[model samples]
Target: MSSEAPDPLQHIGAALFRPLGVEGVYARTALYEDLVERLTAFISRQRDRSAEILRFPPLMSREQLEKSGYLKSFPNLLGCVCALQGTEAEIRAAAERYEEGADWTRALAPADLVLSPAACYPVYPLVARRGAVPPDGLLFDVAADCFRREPSRSLDRLQSFRMREFVRIGPPEEILAFRQHWMERAQRLAAQLALPCRLDAASDPFFGRVGQVMAVSQLQQSLKFELLIPYYAGAKPTACMSFNYHRDQFGVIWGLKDEAGATAHTGCVAFGMDRLAVALFCVHGLELARWPGSVRAALAL
Candidate 1:
């Protein structure tokens, strides 16, 4: 190996994010945690409307995931929880086989839970259970530890991550308006953070030929927009935030209706917490103390 010292930013990142054996998984440092706290606080302080704040665990019901159509779209990226199901004696036998270098994982069976693909996936079903929403509509600040099956060394894409989402369920006009309003607000937020970003029409990486058509339709309808930020030097930017106009997608799927007896429309603004953190480090340098005063003040870090 060359004797040259490592890139200073890489050195700093290594110190801050202790990567586990798995790529994109890390033990975050205290500074990272502090940054997240400040971001969350900044988001909270900027709210003009009251919202029902909800936090869900990482795991979601498999039935719900199926109902949400995620399996049809991105089946390859779905992570299902599975466990060895058998009598104690059978389980012991499987363990023994594994200890002997055999593929004992075959004994594992699907559990009822799957890792949540997005923070908002569980919210619609829960809201549907409450029956019709008021004419004024429902707004929720929901967050969750989310996961995807992607395995990459890129710091911006994680196998497991956290998402902060603001979801709205209401009439079609109101839902679309809500998304447009947040798109503007997100632009302002990026300016405040002094992070260089651009909004672009985007779509999920849907699987197969049929899924490709779906993705095309989604973009054609301008259903999704993403905020892109540079996450690494000499590399193209990555999406750190997504503003989605689901229209009546989730609302129809969950049979959610408004007080007017019309299908409720849905929209959400989702922030990729880890990706934003990485972008900050990329743009602001390794030392928060040396970052621009305005940026520090904006994040209160």
Candidate 2:
């Protein structure tokens, strides 16, 4: 019955992750894998209702991400592609040597792809190149192993995580209105799940001194709001679902124009699938039937 958000790490198991050492959760977790199955199923059902169901891997072109304004705003969180040089046999020997506690470079001969920080960044260009989307616009359902570096290792905040997003592209008003509509819908949906959630304006945790100014501008413009559910002992609450309205940002950058000969106003509803599963587990315990019927059915608990 607590209205406060749980301590970001309140639900994450300490002992469960202790064996992971310094790298910790970034490397692996059995619990996350199990929840992955549940989340994939949930997203699949929702995607079928409105999305084209495009799957994107955990990589984006470094150039594309930079053009998307990522480097300036969140340089600290980005995971860049890197490579190591050596003969093929030397590389093989290094790989084997690393297993034996010898130094082995974790870089590739040529960088493959940069790790994606969000699930939807790749969707914009895909829709753009398709050439002339339907008058109604396009919906993309995408998931990825997103990477972001945080100063803290608290369970609520992670360096690497999975994210699933539903993106909408089209006319200015239609996309803006889509975000506005879903904000309300998420509240009702939260109620059904019996999870106390709040609609609060928010922004990405920008890095460095300049980032402070950027964060201020973001809030002043009211560009984002997250439906937060408490996860840990913290009072501020964890954001579970986010409704973001990117006005002309992605459109201008990716050429996602609409029928009106205007750059599309884009929006997305992002759900922290893993965090949500954690919230439900903590708030309602592992027992599925004991929970509210609607919530149980929604997650197929």
Candidate 3:
């Protein structure tokens, strides 16, 4: 290995964070909340005007996850929710002991929940159970805490974070138009933020041999594109947002049918909330004082 000293985030911050890299950040007494709040409002504005705002718990049912095919497509990266089982008294005692430099023996079992990996994962069933999707469609503004398994540490990649998504399910044309519209809107949003960015077609890093083939096929097929920017001040750009078209995949699986009995088309514009914060920090700097006036006002910083 032609190795230099290891990347600091690699050894130090597995999930919570390290200093040299920012896979995670703890913005404690800092005033980034104003920026985060402004960003959240901005995301909601991008959704359909009539869209319902939905908030989901960080963990989801494993059965729900299975039906969603998350286990199949990304088993390696999935996080199952579990709890440490014990009597109430035992739990209290264990907690007390743990605080005293001891380890608890009761381990968590793989019960029902799993850490949700995306903001839209819980949406399919919610729409499906609502009976037939209207001819017009259903739109939602969803934000959730998400978790993922990662191999390397970079400013862009976080193991646990937040995501906001604008989701739509309806006619194919509507879904196509929604994704296309966001792709264009993203350009404007980036400009408004005054952050330099680029749009590029991207593919998920699938697993193993068959996955490699599928990833290559996906790249050739051009199913997804991302809006990337310089978060780490390096050559490789980080994806701040992505526009995805799922054709009939979720429609077929979740039975999200339009009024005409056609499998409803699904698409989403997803923003990596934490990554956006990172991008803003990297572009604008640690001090909020030097931020561009318009962007600062937009963020209410």
Candidate 4:
């Protein structure tokens, strides 16, 4: 027998994902989809019943993205929708150029929509439109198919993925308390899945020189945390879950206020559904029958 060890990453790719000829984009296998469904159900059972559940499409208004400051903070990562404009003849000429192996995308113009970068982004605007928040504030369970421009072969770094977020909007104290509660709860959930993980202070992948300052500020203020799980032996751990405290940033931009007329503080606990499934398959064998009984029971798989 060969002395080389089995490549875990290769095994995972073959078992869980079907490549779509793109580096980071993939079509999940049935086994993977089943696992994701079970995981979603398990997570849903843990959510606050009072939270309003909302599902958003992958595309969001470009105007909303600009107002949210994402365009400024992560310009490189944002994916804008574009289309060929002008008369039918112009469009046909543009298409003909592509058939002759010339640049065709140059004729494209920006559309009104852009890919959503996060699940919780649209919630703020919707809530703000409803006027002042109640004294108890608002809790939302939101999910979206999000996209980013960065593409790579790294198993955990997907270009397009699903994000599930539990968002809390209220006073600063309440937001802080909510983050703390989820911080602890996430650890327990990891244990229930029998995955080795750690909670670490983290920062967003902000862009440019000014973003460096913003990242430092975020770390100093303890604004972000991630639940990291090792996916392969030699590689660094992957972040499967993130906890973020947005302070009053979203409130200020969207004009969201609490019953007392103060800008609402916002925080969210986000689960990387694809990354979590990969982690599960990495820790436990790909075979569902081989997984721990407790974990199977927890997910009711």
Query: Listing every candidate in turn, what is its Cα RMSD in Å to the true structure after a full C-alpha superposition?
Result: 2.3, 4.7, 4.3, 2.3
lDDT of 2 by residue, 1-301 (tens): 9998654444455422443454325443565455557656865665537777766777898878888898888888888777766788877786887788976765455464689999998887777787765678877787787877664556566666678888888876777888898898778777767887788999878888888888888899988999888753455688988988888898888887766667777889998876776676666655556877877677676
The segments of candidate 1 whose C-alpha lies over 4 angstroms from its true place after superposition are 1-9, 232-234
Candidate 2's displacement at residue 210, Å, is 2.1
Q: Which candidate wins on lDDT? A: 4
Is candidate 2 or 3 superior in TM-score?
3
Supply every candidate's count of residue pairs whose N, Cα or C atoms clash at under 3 angstroms.
0, 10, 0, 0
Those runs of model 4 whose alpha carbons end farther than 4 Å from true positions after fitting are 1-7
Q: Which scores better on TM-score, 2 or 4? A: 4
Better model by lDDT: candidate 2 vs candidate 4: 4
How high is the lDDT of residue 301 in model 2?
Answer: 60
Please give the range of 10 consecutive residues that has the lowest summed lDDT in model 3: 8-17
Report lDDT (Cα) of residue 44, candidate 1. Answer: 81
lDDT of 1 by residue, 1-301 (tens): 8998555357557756987889877899997888888888888876656799999999989999999999999999999999988899999998899789999988999999999989999999999999998898889998999989999866777898999999998988888898999889998998988898889999989999998999999999999999998765666888999999988889889999977789998999999988888788888877899999898899876
Superpose all Cα atoms of candidate 2 onto the true structure and report the RMSD in Å to 1 decimal: 4.7
Model 1, residue 144: C-alpha shift (Å): 0.7
Range of the 10 consecutive residues with the lowest summed lDDT in candidate 2? 15-24
Winner on TM-score between 1 and 4 is 4
In candidate 4, which residue pairs get closer than 3 Å at backbone N, Cα or C atoms, i.e. clash? none
